[model samples]
Target: MKEAENRACEVMLHAGLLPQLATMETIAAAAGPVLEPFVQYLLRHISTPRGVDGVSPFELNAALANALIEGEEALTGLVSLAVSIVPLAPAAATTNSSSLTAATSGGVCSVSSLTRVRLTLHPAYPLNLIATDSFLNLHTMLWTLSLQLQWVAQSLIAARVCLWKESQSQKRSGTDNNTTFSTTTAPSTRAVQQEMLHLVHAVRQHMLTHVENTSVRMRRGIATCGSLREMQKQCGEYEEELRHGCLLHDTSSSQLGSRKWHNHNDGPAASASGSPELHSSLLEVLESSLRHCILLGHARQAKILINKAKQAQLEAEDAEQEALALDSLEFAKQKFSQITCAVAATEREFEGHRVAFMERVSVYGSEAGAHSDAARALLAAVDIQGRWQPQKGT
Candidate 1:
């Protein structure tokens, strides 16, 4: 905007149009055609960093950074957990005398290894445009963004023209009424001019700030731009991502060793004590009770036999609980795979918007300013009607 404004000022000065003769109509007509390119430049500087239409994955997916950090911690926890727990099998004691597993209160634990490992991505939200990365979807978004920004720029240009018109109106009326838009109505003219200038600066600054922020995954330390507060947030999230970063990753991973093949275990009810061998166990208890009941008529030892069976049942339950923990890990692995694809698709769409933005910024920046000298000259000849503004040399 500054660049274009400077160039337009130069064109008017060089044309030698009588300054007093330059009416609002003449100025508008002179600048109209030349200002179109500047409008585009300003819009790109304003809207590109916000997202193609203000929905950016980088902005949307801050949870991915936390997920990444805690995820490593969770993984570290899992490893420590496995090492601490997985060796209570009675077979482990017999198989390796050198094993250092803690003694189980239950005679044995059925879970004997790290049966699974799973990952989970964070902040799983449901979305409407699930297939947002498709080329059709991406391009349509860019088209919408272009139209929105263009409308804003056009409205601003129209406002500048109206301000100029109102300035001319004041000169004609010679009313010290101190009006703004018309001879009768009023607003702060200086405020309007100052705001317009500040607005252009804001557009350029907004674009640059976000451009740096979006690179959180790539840059490090002071290279990534953000406020002091954001830098603090970046410390943990940023460090973990860099530590885990592998640039060339293969997305076609078939599995994560999350489940044991053909090892389907029965439910807790059956595993703990619901077997039809239940009949034999019950029969044994009944016989022992009968034999002791007679002695209880004379005080027999039936309670001791029943207590032994109860102890065995408690051990089976402990084993069942450990197996469920391993199963939970496997489920986590499944969730990770599903969410990874979704995240990738989103990031790809974000890249598309950025690329579209950069292509435009590059093209506009290639030229120093709008080429409007010819247009201004034509309008001057028509409006000023041969009244030559005196040249410095003349």
Candidate 2:
């Protein structure tokens, strides 16, 4: 077992995936105490120098940097998948008390425990020997992935909490009738909504930070283009017009200033006219940025809906508990109206973003057919909002 573990560590080190291996160790630690030894072994392996004799430190570091980048891409894909599937799972399940208890308690403990471990163990990769720009990019990706994982973990926790509460409610009610189940489920729904609101707020903050970092990197890339060679390197191609303009300048100093000024004026235009791969990549980044913004908006809307639903549930419960003069039917009508208003408001907000998202895709779609198709597919996968129905007795 020790030999196998060492061999695995050796492969990870040679592939420049020590950081990723560390991350996996952190994730695996969630499975329980059984994996503690494995995690410790990984920690020791990475910290100890097991040199690849022929490879220079610079080369190894470069490979590690590339691995960081690739891992980021993989994490982004996972986040996209998680977001797409978030609403597909039923928020609450109706089952026998025994089955529900077994499912919720057992499942929640294992999944949430593991995910929580990952959330806690995400480390700040050391930057002592790394280039500033590369480190910044690497850190941004790491932060984004960490946040995405946190969101997924929190979502799972919320589901688990809701399920556990439902199981408890089922046991308390001790009846299989629909009316009893619905009545008992109301409080749990409110509880779940509360947890979801907190999770969504955290996710929105992280997403905003991610978007800011990405924008800063994009701006930096555009601002640093200073010559034909630099422009070609950055933008991936130079037009004949730009090449001729470069030749027209008299002195090296003037040419340098001219190139900077010209690039500043025409950076977007140059990117538009650059190689297809370069243009597509830029568009993909923009699309991803916009998608994150849309996600933030969606999260905010979800919180609002949950708040409204909770408020309605509370009002209904209060009306029942108090033998007030106010008619229950009238109170129910008022609460339902408030929920409808909230839903309408959410729909309006989502529609605005949907329009903006579609406009972006349409503008870029003509330029990059394949990317636009993929973007459209992603857009299709996003749920505007689930259909709202008033719970019985509310």
Candidate 3:
């Protein structure tokens, strides 16, 4: 009886239960009143000369101990057998002081040495196996879904690029098609821009899912079930995981945008971006900030972009409007010939405003150094998060 109770206590202790809670004295005291009778009956049966192919108590106990201590696979099978027999062993189940819950006809058996060991050996392993199996079965379907979504994002980007280029080309061609386009073209263009914006938003949103999942798993991996030292070790690994992933992500994204710019806009094809030095420096700073944000797990310079861009856009709009008003006035100056001096001064002022407006647009467009920097920052955020995958097994 003491041996059986001791074995049960050991199983509980290994399963992360407090040792004091499953102490030998407590278990023995708890099982004494009811367990003594079952033990006596079993002993009497085994001792009988005509015992049904009986095994000796010493032999049986030795075999059981050996199996429980060394034969993990066999022990697990025994535990399953015990759980299965719980319905027929109501009294035996009730007398046991262990904590494993196995449902049975009479009630529930709460003694499972096997389950405890399996859980102790590798808690994450079982969970990983289950998740991986599920993922495998559905991976093909998920890939199809991902491809469709990627197609949408790519299509929207391509369309926006095409339309923007076409608009610039038309302006360069001295086309006066604005009058013909007044009916539906403006609305259609707006719709396309809106769709493109929606697609960008969707892509960004989907990227967040991967980041969130990675965060959750990292937290879980760092969670401690043992002592403080173990916890610290787990936490250190988690931090390393975060730092490495962030740095790699930031660097990779920066390089991706740099390569794209080199291929499309930077190579001698009009040198869209002005001030190469400023552009390169800005990109470096932005990329650094993005890396900092990823490692620290928070946005660092997102506000800087917001504040700067807002101011720049406002100034650009005001300048653009002033220039347009001056142009209109200059066009209608024949009737007001007396205001020729005013018109000339206004034209000079408009030219100044035009330069300022161009500077701002160039800054915002692929032509300005700031554009390259901002593009690197934003794309780094998007691209890094996009390619991120939170997998198990480190």
Whole-model Cα lDDT per candidate?
A: 0.27, 0.31, 0.31
Which prediction has more favorable TM-score, 1 or 2?
2
Winner by TM-score: 2
Clashing pairs in 1: 295-298, 295-299, 296-299
Which segments of model 1 are wrong by more than 4 Å? Answer: 1-150, 173-204, 212-394
Count of backbone collisions within predicted model 1? 3
Candidate 3 lDDT (Cα, whole model)?
0.31
Quantify how close model 3 is to the true structure by its C-alpha RMSD in Å: 30.8
lDDT tens string, model 1, 44-78? 43222221223223432343234324442222211
If candidate 1 were superposed on the true structure by all CA atoms, what would the RMSD be? 37.1
Tens digit of lDDT per residue, candidate 2, span 32-139? Answer: 233333333222222212211222334433433344344433421111111000111233222322363332122221111121121112223221111133323233
Arranged by lDDT with the best first, the candidates are: 2, 3, 1
Indicate the worst ten consecutive residues by lDDT in candidate 2.
Answer: 79-88
For candidate 1, give the lDDT of residue 147: 28
> Which scores better on lDDT, 1 or 2?
2
Q: Estimate the TM-score for candidate 3.
A: 0.23
What are the models' TM-scores?
Answer: 0.20, 0.27, 0.23
